[model samples]
Target: MGKTTRYRFREYHVTAVADPMALPIFEAVCVTGEERNCAAASGELHAPEELTRWIAGHCAQTGHQSYEQTTRTIVRAEPGAWQ
Candidate 1:
């Protein structure tokens, strides 16, 4: 039997959220499989559009496929987080 190549993903948290005004302070939403080893509070808040573009650019540069699919997995403004 041959060894399996496990798919590893990394999560990068940006200073954003579903409802930034919900809490006393705006907290970032955690996105998985984007930036590599980025600190939770490393950068400023990025809107949904900006975030998706950022991911696509990163993936294209790194020769990673499925960036488009990953972009569709983000949460919407409404409830039921599965989109």
Candidate 2:
């Protein structure tokens, strides 16, 4: 019998929020996957969704203290995995 390899995947939601004063500030909101604990597989959400959720949550919590906002998200996938 041949040996089988196991894989894992994790997703993180990175986000950023800025103030209207032209000061670019950013933050990260991590939404990890089930296999995130595994050191093998890891992944993250695309850009748009990650940024949006981050900003929204930040604003909601902080009472929309900032203005003229921009958002961005990123996906980090593990190597040697069939995504």
Candidate 3:
């Protein structure tokens, strides 16, 4: 059998929805797991609050309920920070 991988929910960003004028818009976020060579996975949720709920749901379904949220930091550093 092949090895299994686990991914943790990172962050979510509001994208679009069926109606552009809707109060709550759909969101898309990238999730990364233990598989180093694997690419990031994306999931969509109807609302902002639903994003976190969906992530927890997925973790429970995948037998990874112990996945806890690590440090979450948003960077606004200068462009040269990448150097």
lDDT of each: 0.40, 0.43, 0.43
What residue pairs are clashing in model 2? 8-41, 10-43, 47-73
The stretch of ten residues in a row with the least summed lDDT in candidate 2 is: 37-46
Q: Taking the tens digit of each residue's C-alpha lDDT, what string does model 3 give over 1-83?
A: 99999997655444333343434433433344566322222244445576677556666565443333332223332322221
Best by TM-score: 3
TM-score of each: 0.28, 0.25, 0.31
| lDDT per residue as tens, model 2, 1-83 | 99999998765554344333443333344332355421211123335465567656655654543333333333343345333
CA lDDT for candidate 1: 0.40
Q: What value of lDDT does candidate 2 attain over all alpha carbons? A: 0.43
TM-score of 1: 0.28
Model 3 scores a C-alpha lDDT of: 0.43
Candidate order by TM-score, decreasing, is 3, 1, 2
